[model samples]
Target chain A: MSGVAVRAGLFEQTDAGVTLLGDRCRTCDAHQFPRAGICTLCGAPDPVPVQLAATGTLWAWTWVTAPPPGYDGPVPYGFGVVELPEGLRVITRLVLDPDVAPTVGQPMRAVLDTVGTDPESGHDLVSWAFSPLDASVGL
Target chain B: MTTSEVVVAGVGIHPFGRFGDRTATDLGVVAARAALAEAGVTAREQIGITFCGTAYGGVASGHRVMSALARSGGPIVDVEAGCASGAAALMLAASAIRSGQHETVLVLGLEKMPAGVIRSSFFAPWQEQAGLTPAPAYFALRAQRLMATAQLTTRDLATVVVKNRANGVANPDAMFRTAVTVDEVLASRLICPPLHLFMLCSPNAGAAAVVLRRARPDDAGAGSVRLRAAALRSHLPGDVLGEATPLSGLAVDDIPAASTLAATAAYEEAGLGPDDLDLVECQDTDAARELLAYEELGLCGPGECGRLLRDGTTAPNGALPVNVSGGLLSKGEPLGASALGQVVELVRQLRGEAGARQVDGARVALAHTVGRGANASVTILTR
Candidate 1:
């Protein structure tokens, strides 16, 4: 599956499991989260891609009892705000338990999960997710 | 700032309990009738505009209800901005009144949250897929942050519930009047870590409506509460992923960005300072959040809200009464209706109608409401 040409939406996947391929702003040098077509900080065209780590520490986490409205994801899933070493905090499902009690200062590893698919277009949408890594299950 | 005058010509609230005799629409019609009667208006036919705010049901939901009331055809609009939807619609009505667009406007909020634990697929696709629901999650995240940085404990937060529920007990309008203990709050089923089921708002079905118009000749002389300042803003530009990045180390204070924008705009509009506010309707989706709002809204110095709670400063008879409406925590959040209900309660307090839990001489009140996408609104009322 490594070279499966996984119909990515033109964003680069980090070896650390972060799927957002982003560019660095030449002006501000700020690293963007989701891959950008241009430097969001400077409006500079064609920002470059920088590989990121697939794991981060759990800054905070919680159980999403009810998703907002009209989200078709599985119920009772755990979600957390993971803090990547690169300095971005992003939200993604913690695919471990319905009761993933993500405390402060926990270790988290990133992965790609299927978000949804459009039947008419037949394209699969994938997004980033994180899981707490057990000490016995180190990444 | 020059102000456009308006009055709460009438008010209505359906009872807050699980009675399956009627649907959300039935609940809405009931409140609508009560409002028209209280306003001394014959029908929606006299009203030039209609605004309904709800998040739980159908599209064109408000319009359908307007038609049900048999008073359609002016300009029926739908407003949904998380829990602040009702307040947002009221902002629109106030705007219309000031501009002389319409004299009498009916603004109502209705919602019927499915029974029991509020779970399931009701989120933005990215958010739902990522797993950050509403209320408890945000509150838990804020609580965790407070625990990490503010040196607050679950016990301090529990007092918010104890006080608000006690406040709810006095108001027959509140849903859960049975007061609970901090130990009870601590022992309840954990929704997220320190947050327990008791510490959070209940999911209930209810509708609250308000009728507004230009004040009558004698109405301004007595028994009328006037609108002061109404300010609403979404969270200022910032990445809100509660710590998915290296920057998660920064506290809301350190950022000095999101809440600052909202507080500045709110205070500026009211032409008042935090010192001027006698009572507040701060968001308390959970106990932790109630404390955070104290800091964020400048009621206390950052990181000292726990001190305020533990010392009984935010209690019912405290210096500044907070959430005399039992807040979202004790009263439960019905999405669209919850925030506006906060406004209604503030109007009651400023009008000296809040019977038992009434602030002794509440001359000014603030109602802070938030919606999805980090939007925030603050409304101030004075007697």
Candidate 2:
């Protein structure tokens, strides 16, 4: 379950679980994923980094049948918006059961998994993704 | 500065479709020349400035087009706002004319998009690798939400394609001329759940241009189309899931979308409402987006778009005929040329030149486009 992260500064894997790295505004309490130096809502500089909630509700979902440019992942993979408890809706890759269609309001939990392979380095690319909480043990 | 009424002196377009050998400058020059000819503007000094709208066109795209025409002395600025690029340029041109800064200004929109599904550089390399780019998946995700909350069904989505493609049959400039049935559209390949192949628009090459000038007293009697109102707005903060932000937004925030903001401002500026519009050309990047536009533009109430379509209110012969020029769904979205192309179609219809797709007694029209960066533009024109 260990590999090179697709990108740095996005998420961290600990013995406890996978948590996304984000920033929270000290002034207005706004949250941003992939962590920003300044708060977009209040324009407050130097927002502090924080770990986002591990679980969220599915806001929307879809299956990408065709691969986008530079995407070396499996075709027809699940993708969706997950609204975390902190009020941030994060767009992420979805790990789903083949026969189950995703529905709004379903509970999803974050996981670090292989999303694709880097075309240049030929290494398995790992990134933060979400999976149905009740469906399976792991992606 | 004394403000003046601005009029669309002329409009021209290069047909929308795939053009393998043609460059963006070539497409832009042809449209610009036609617009100049139609406006009776022969001398280069007659044009005070030039604005070009393009997303894919490279550096100095406007300069390149103007140089090609040998009319390069004036200020040639290029504008980009994703799919709203043309509308943004037109907004600037109209403002210049209204402020009396220039007697005449030329606006050109052109694009030579790369083949296959659009690969915008808007996303970071990691985002592209993660498959979060604004492509079919993002569109499908939005459509999925609409279906859940707006009473939109997969069948309703098919009906939009059916209506627009049928309308495209009448527009020679449209990329898709053949009418498709709901059955055929539904039977097409499913790019995503709830969205079929026909539901999406093709990104291709095309160009459209407009000539704006301060209206003279004689123009009142000449059936000239006046630029009644032109408004552009960007996405407000806190809708993490809204089109504005690429990755995040506050889920509970209730800010209005860019389309609503732009439409509201345009309606106020023109002293008109949705009831005043006789026809409309809205962005139909996907079938569901057109329906979403219905609510966003105030044509119908929220969660009421499905009923409006089922009741045939947006049809060719309906009370408010929309996309009579086939929209991006049929004409194919060249990004930069899209909104200006809609303007060209509206001008033709107002002049009684839209032979097959004419809405009877059409007098007022609106063109709406929204795209990446969450930019939205709404333009109202009157005969």
Candidate 3:
């Protein structure tokens, strides 16, 4: 079953798994996530859109117990910077149990999960997260 | 480099606490008047220009503050640089004095934050929608990494809270003047893992002001404290770990953080090293942040903060006294007013007027602040 992504142009679902999306500068080979109108590295006005790696390593992680405004996720959730093999880091949720902790340098794979159900539309608001490659995934 | 000297003649502050009924103008005008009164400078005649720093005061904040005091007809500029708004204003005023452009300028930092967790809009819409936008989450991420790499623990972090809370006891201007224990700090509700609720600063209301002037040769008996240097810097290109940076950070590590760059420039401008500092009032938005600041401000070697806190090196009477005003941890963060509050404390300490919180024989002091928009500022004062 397909659900609406929390934000467009961030990731795409495929048979293999979910892959993060970004833009790559052809002139300087710089990569930016969520794409950019202008390349931050080479000053190019337009860059090529590309899919990011499905697997990465957890660089740093934190558990946010207090939710900020505009958030609809569960309380006391985990999120962190996941370093892709191509040397780019993206901030995304670490989809794990509330009690489980993520270790730095641990392998993680992008996955699609339902963040919450829209109150008005009654549709699942899907979001991307990083799940541990070695452990059983739960959300 | 013989730079022209700019001195802080006087400072005034509206006690940092929740003022639900007061507006930013009321606090700003009161503090401005007190500073001008203490400086023996009339607002309309002696002051040449005014700079008001505020993040949420809206437009014409300077004009509103001036009009409230029945003083005007001079240029008053409003500035906003997140939490470092006051430091940015101080730097501009000092530069004007150093350039010989203006002799006397009044700088005011004021804020009246909305009650609740600060709903910062620094992150993208997607990040905020996904619950990745809380301020403590970022602090905790850094704390976790620093603990892993620097050999720090939750206990070490708790010690910083304990020290700052105890320091608050002597500061009447602080919102939390009661001392707390390490156990209480560690046992407090965790806003984020490794960061307790008590370890974080609330978004509160307050105001602080300083009067700066070019010193004269015959001003020997004056209450002026020399503004040795006021330096402001922004984050280098690849500062991924910075609070203001985008969620997707560059994986590069060669670029320095804004605080380090600002501190280096301040030391060079002041011609004084960290060893010469009698006391410091660096940013302590959280307990772990104070440890990060120790390294960024060149107070200690990297990875040595754990040992430093355990040995009481930064206590009130330790080798280096930091945050004698209880820091934002106890004062709560008033955003625009936070850095100026640090300046007020430093001025009091350098002038030997800090009472029970005084660092013995403190003749030189430093005030540092780092804020969103990747801004960092360091101001050094000497007596």
Each model's backbone clash number:
21, 2, 0
Cα RMSDs of all predictions? 4.5, 1.7, 2.0
The ten-residue window of minimal lDDT in model 1 chain A covers A1-10
What's the i-RMS for candidate 3 in angstroms? 1.7
DockQ of each: 0.30, 0.74, 0.68
Model 1 C-alpha lDDT per residue in residues A1-139, reported as the tens digit of each score: 1321123442345443444444566675656655668764457777778655567777777776554454455556565677766665655566665434446678877665554554346555455567776632211
Clashing pairs in 2: B240-B248, B240-B249
Task: Name the TM-score of chain A in model 2.
Answer: 0.92
Give lDDT tens digits, candidate 3, residues B1-383. Answer: 13377778889999989987899999998899899888888648677889899999999998999998847588899989888999999999998888888889999999999866777667677667777677777788888878987899898888898999999999999999999998999889978788898888888999999999888775454355898888988875545578556657677755677899999999999999999998889888888899999988988888887777888789998988889899998999899899999999999988889999989888889999997788899999988
Model 2, position B24, has a per-residue lDDT of 86
Among all candidates shown, the one with the greatest TM-score: 2
Tens digits of per-residue lDDT, candidate 2, A43-121, equal 9999999999898999988888888997877777788889999989898888887688778898999986677887777
Q: What is the lDDT of residue A1 in candidate 1?
A: 12
Per-model TM-score on C-alpha atoms: 0.84, 0.97, 0.95
Give the TM-score of chain A, superposed on the true chain A, for all candidates in the order listed.
Answer: 0.70, 0.92, 0.91
Model 2, docking class: medium
Error of 1 at B23 (Å): 1.9
Is candidate 1 or 3 superior in TM-score?
3
